[model samples]
Target: MSSGGSAQRPEGLGTRTSRGIYVSATTPGSGKSLVALGLAEALHSHTDRIGFFKPVVAGTTPDADPMVALIRSRYNLDPAVCRGGLTAREVRKYLAEGKREEIGARTVDVFSEIAAQCDVVVVEGTDLVGQDSAVEFALNARLANDLGCPMVAVVSGRDRTPEEIADAVDVARKELQAAHCSLLMMMVNRAAPQHLDEISAAIRPGVSHRPVYVIPEIEEISRPTTGEVSSLLALRQIAGRADMEREVRDVKVAAMSVANFIGVLETGDLVIVPGDRADIMVGALASTFSPEFPVPSAMILTGGLSPDEHILPLLAPAPFPIFAYPEDTYHAARSVSEVRSEIWSGQRRKVASALGAWSKRVDDAEILERLNLPRPETMTPLRFLHELVGRARVDRRHIVLPEGTDVRILRAAEILHRRDVCDLTILGDDGQVREIAGSNGISLSGMPILNPATSDLRERFAHEYARLRAHRGVDLPRALEAMLDVSYFGTMMVQLGLVDGMVSGAAHTTAHTIRPALEFVKTSPGVKVVSSVFFMLLPDRVLVYGDCAVNPEPDAEQLADIAIASAETAAQFGVLPRVAMLSYSTGASGSGATVDKVRRATELVRERRPDLAVEGPIQYDAAVDASIAATKLPGSNVAGQATVFIFPDLNTGNNTYKAVQQSAGAVAVGPVLQGLRKPVNDLSRGCTVEDIVNTVAITAVQAQAVHAQTLQAQAG
Candidate 1:
């Protein structure tokens, strides 16, 4: 649909703005519109208040514009907002008159109306056909900047060499940068089948921060159905009008004998034969019912052809539509061949097929993550989770869910799998898991379910467990029994590099989940104690509290390790690490055993990791409140700006985190266990599905971080 907004909003339209992503194309026929549709569908799954906008639409009328009508109907977006954009004619007129800024001004004026009502608007750029692509490209860049939305650039790869496609992508990136438009991701659509790998490789190195996807051309999506042909060609239907929606895959001119024509018939062939050929009609109609024969899409009888009245009864039950034309067979065949294939909003079957193909090629989760929307001034729980999930999606990691028997685990697994946030393997009896999932209306059709009891890895895992714990006198029998426990099996998977991480404790104790990991996975080299951190999402920012879930009665040395690990964890999740070794007193105000332990821990942290910014022996009020810190610990770097707080022992750590979580209404995302050889995170036994999902995401990110560190160390 074209621009639907009036010149301006009604009385008192303030300057409030909205967040959105712009879908722009490198050239025409780039399938950018399809990407917009897929994006709207993806956003709908996350929220219902979704909006679709086009800065410049192909047409002005909603009925005349298939894409805008489709978005409005499919996503239930307001038609007015979907149609709110400038027509190409209006944009060109402004540009031609040296009024480029006018184009941005008018578009933004319209966008403001749409953005005012919706949480996010998906803005589609201009179709590059019938105009100079350079101008259209420049216009897209300007409009994206004016609307204050990041872009997902769709590069057209069809009919171009890999080198040319790469060149186009580079040009798009440069132009966007020149206009100061932010890029979210790069998608190359309709890429040549043979050159997919090359095109994808060439365009990615320059934009490593963004995810790149190369989707090969799908033929079914470009084929028009019989109904579209009938509507476009104005054919008179003879029979089976209901079957006109069948696709016309190929065109066949049957001017030969019945036997000869039947031999040439192929599936989805639109047969154009002369009228009154009873023999030809019978053979074609009869083949439709036979399983062995190829099914024709529809038959077009030319030269005013109509079967004899006596044969009308036999043709009434035709599986495909039959149409009559006033022209000859040659013209009818030409018309069928020239039928323009377009993804119309009315064609539900074609739209569904197109979306399925689009989804297969495009990872919407990664795209959403790359958006990295403008953050709020305050770090709310929702915003923290958003950032967490986004980081995990950018590079997916395989995480095993050990507590597959728990309904919450199953549901969270399904959600994670469906979102493509990461690859997940569920450990349990396959049948029972599926039965529970099925009974609960959860679709685990494509999710991988691994049964540890019957798996080939069981024997290997048991042997490895025995070997690793030989000093503890664990024999094959004892290790084998331990391997039967899903937690042990999952931790073994992480240790053996079968999976990137493990997430459990949904249906087990914290000890049951962490013991296996501690026994076998152990701690990374140079790390003295295995500790945990809870990401305390306060009203203003996210704070990390360490040794909250593990390490009971830790001494000064162990407390130092937890402080360092927690600082690293905070930095890993995009928080600035200002370490605060919290105590019962501020500075040297008190001299109790706990205060002495914290003071010693702070000294140890400074000696070991001089690069870390750590301060300690501080009270909670002095550690957090800048005004109070000024009164108590003057000129202290981490007195009031701490993002990582290390507790002296588990008794203080656990209770403090819990108290803050409940009393402050803050979201405690973890006790995310850090300093492990492999990432194995534990969840609360009473955790919800959302909790499990977040923990798995955190684990995946930890695995990624660990891997990067290993790589960097090797290179060093």
Candidate 2:
């Protein structure tokens, strides 16, 4: 039954060029779908161009394969490629008629075509059912080898002793290895809580080459929803259709009196009783809506009877589903007990539960490392945005929003607060800020709002400002007047270490917002000039456009510094830095003073930081397109894979960023100022609430990096 070969040392399959993994199981009901879904989600954080393939599907039509549909819909994968793989009947018929060669060729051709277009693919194997067990095992092994991918074997641990679990894994591992398919990892699913340690210890020695993971049985993923039960039992809908998707954890038969039935009820319980039991039906429905009692998932009425007329209207508004069946109470209960919940397209709760459990239980880092899957080169817009918030939350930084009264700023503040991304302070009149927020439907209850004119820090900040600016200024009066302005006051907070960063410019000019920072916060110790970059979130990847909003026209050395700063910024934000110094012509194709400046800047960058992959005097097309780059700059490393784009001047950089932002519908997230002693970012006056939120998140992350560097320096 297995694809035959000598069992040699198990080597990892899938070279650096290979882009997929095959997930298979030794037995049916191994929770293979759960593992597949979780694996897809985990890979998504690394790359968005993930593909799913279920070669040898079970049903005739695509709709019968719900897992494929669910993965496609949830991750927004291409529909054309996401249809289920070959049907089970087709494969089974071919195998029965000894058409193994045809099946193998077709599977390889189809999988190659799909894998070529994706960064990674997850291939699910056929279920091992009665009479087809040997054929299924052979097919899974042959497909894994033919696809040039590693195999993840899942073993069902339910009702199995420790020795049995180990035996199952050992046999599967040896079979897969003999078929020349590398075993990436083995997962023992649905094992008893107390038996998990024993089972792991038993299987550890048998599969010592690869890791073994044991996922405890989770009921949330195992229980059927009310809608599924209705479909399974052919029951008639009484009412509460809106709540049909609620999950059923336990099923109870209410044959006793109402008092005793109430005591036995639990949350997500499905009650089965005769329709004539008015007391049980009414009480079950009432408890679902009550705050004091456990809410049942649904109520099943049996015995071909109906509830009282008054109960019908109440059922309509119940928080759970109500079903009526013609079968007697005993038969209905028996039918319910045998129902098995399955993972389907519409069961979003179950999908989410599976992903959560897998993320918590699996050691994904070790698996990815063993597979030799490198870090992805590009990031999607959504993943980038989420990573910003997640990175900020790890070490919460205090951010101050000076333009707090502006509606967009207030809205962004509310969102950041709800996400718990950062600790925030707003410098403005407390009462006026609350009033404006209330009118705009935003809550600022727990956020601190201060008025510089009435605050205790006003005098202290004014004194500090006067002392810092003593050579140019006369007295404390001028400093006090400047402190009344929110921008100046907020910048003082960052300078005094009261807040880690400040985001302004929503309603103010960039000059007005950054003037105080330039005066007091200044650049980092080694940096002579401060610069900024915009994170242009294009459809496929994120690009960094630097000095777009700063340094209008720089000389050669300044441009070099900007290039280095932009590269560092890109690396900090999870983008690999392949810098392209953009100009009007490809390398040495044309000559002019502008071109000369770029060429000199490129040389300066190479001289200063030899580690950076940089190329210059390149046109935009050559910098981003591989074919053009091949013709223009044949051996240049950074020409075709540029992630950080450094512009020659403000006129070129600003216009290009705007054109791309408007035409391509890209999300430009900065004007993020770099080289500051602390982190101070300026927003566009035309920015949206989302733009402000993103800026604050970026600021928080920047502050965290700065803090980490400082700690390292002190320890050294």
Candidate with top lDDT is: 2
The global C-alpha lDDT for each of the candidates, from Candidate 1 onward, is 0.78, 0.81
Error in Å for residue 544 of model 1: 0.8
Clashes of 1: 4
Model 2 worst lDDT window (10 residues): 1-10
Candidate 2 deviant stretches above 4 angstroms: 1-19, 45-48, 178-180, 194-198, 205-208, 234-237, 344-346, 373-375, 382-538, 543-572, 575-716
Could you tell me which residue pairs clash in candidate 1? 3-85, 4-83, 4-84, 275-305
TM-score of model 2 (CA atoms): 0.60
Question: Which regions of candidate 1 are displaced past 4 Å?
Answer: 1-387, 393-396, 712-716
